[model samples]
Target: MDKIKIRGLEIWAKHGVFPEENVLGQKFVISADLYTNTRSAGKSDDLTQSIHYGEVCQFMKTFMEEHTYQLIETVAEKLAEELLLVFEHLQGIRLEIAKPWAPVGLPLDTVSVEISRFWHRAYLALGSNLGDKEAYLRQGIQGLQDRKDCRVTAVSSFLRTAPYGGVAQDDFLNACLELDTLLTPEELLDVMHEIEQEAGRERLIHWGPRTLDLDIIFYDDIVYDTPELHIPHIDMQNRDFVLNPLAELCPAYRHPLLKKTVEELKNALTEPEEAHAK
Candidate 1:
């Protein structure tokens, strides 16, 4: 990653809890470190290959002046998201918003809010065994795509597979997708749950059946385990339904803990005595 630094860019904006402060704008100093791949720009000396700091500064100024928010936290968050969304070359950002004229009764040099935000790559497994299976899968994909913070980068062909867990349920439609998202793991889970609920999912049985099932299989090669969620989904390697679709989207994607590629995992799984697929 390369850096594009912009420091002490000053702007006048109305944002505060106090009425007087809102009426009379105050000076805000903003600084940002934009992350990206500048190799092309450096090699070709082409401005188009790099993020333009001048354009970014102008965008920040315009954005700050146009919006009115009570908290600098909100300003920083909104600004960071907008910059990432607007600038294709920018991969991440560390932004700081300093309020020189704080309304605090005590004398202080400045009050500021700083945050680092970046896009993350995540893989998900999608499954549906109930009514309108394919429709539910499409709805789940669309739900994720509809969010500004998430992008569906690739989708695998949906496959029909026999039910796991010996629940005697109908065959399931399963698939996988690659996601580029700004949401954290927990946040992404919440979104998945929301999408599942929208499709009328119920969790009465353990892997029994559902309208939609969205599982986070991987997040940026990081291993995460908690009571509520687990990355590199615990049992994905043994399930052909998951591995088959995943191999389609990312055959070389390695599991952090298992250290095996999707293709390898799929090939290694021992076929059940009863066929797992229709």
Candidate 2:
């Protein structure tokens, strides 16, 4: 990734815990390292192929002056999100906000808040066995797309498959999707659960039946597990319903743990069944 650095840009803004600081305002310094692909811009010598540092500086200056917050931490967080949203070419940002006029009695030079934020790739599996199965799955996808922090990049054709978990139930409509999001894994899970609730999902039966079931199959090739959620979703390699739809979107995507592509896993799971029928 290439970077466009802007350092020591100063601005006057009202942001502090003390009332006087808000009333009188103070000087603050801002710096940022914008991440993007500058290869095209460099090769063609075209500004349109890259993010404009001057435009970014102006946007940052105006944003800081327009908003009033009690802490520089809030300022940095909000500013980074806005920059990433407004600038289509920007992939990530490392931002620092320095407050030179600290009210502390000490002779410290300054106080600053620095942080890094970026977009993350996540894959999700969608399933529904109850009424209007396809509709429920579509609604779930729409729910994720509706969030500003999440974007649905690709989706697979929904397939009807027999229910798993050894619980006799109707066939389920299953599919997979690729997501580009700024939300953390936990935050994304919360959003999925909210969408499920909106679709009238219930936990009354374990895999017995559901209106909507959204599971996080992968997130940036990272392994994660918790009491409430699991990444790479438990036993996903064994479930064709998951692999089939996922392979449609990303056949070459490898499992972080198993170290096999989706196509490999799908074939490995089905080959034995085919052999038995021979």
RMSD of each: 2.7, 1.0
**Clashing residue pairs, candidate 2?**
none
Count of backbone collisions within predicted model 2? 0
* Model 2, global lDDT: 0.94
Worst 10 residues of 1 by lDDT: 269-278
- Taking all chains together, each candidate's TM-score versus the true structure is 0.94, 0.98
Candidate 1's C-alpha runs over 4 A off are: 270-278
lDDT of each: 0.94, 0.94
Residue lDDT tens for model 2, 1-278? 89999999999999999999888999999989999999999999999999999999999999988999998899999999999888989999999999998999999999999999999999999999999998999999999999988999999999989999999889999999999998999999999999999999999977789999999999998999899888888889989999999999999999999999999999999999999999
State the lDDT of candidate 1 residue by residue for 1-278, as single tens digits.
78999999999999988888788999999999999999999999999999999999999999999999999999999999999999999899999999998988899999999999999999999999999999999999999999999999999999999999989899999999999999999999999999999999988999799999999999999999999999879999889999999999889988989988999888888545336763
Which clashing pairs does model 1 show? none
What's the CA error at residue 208 for candidate 1, in Å? 1.2
Quote the lDDT for 6 in model 1.
Answer: 97
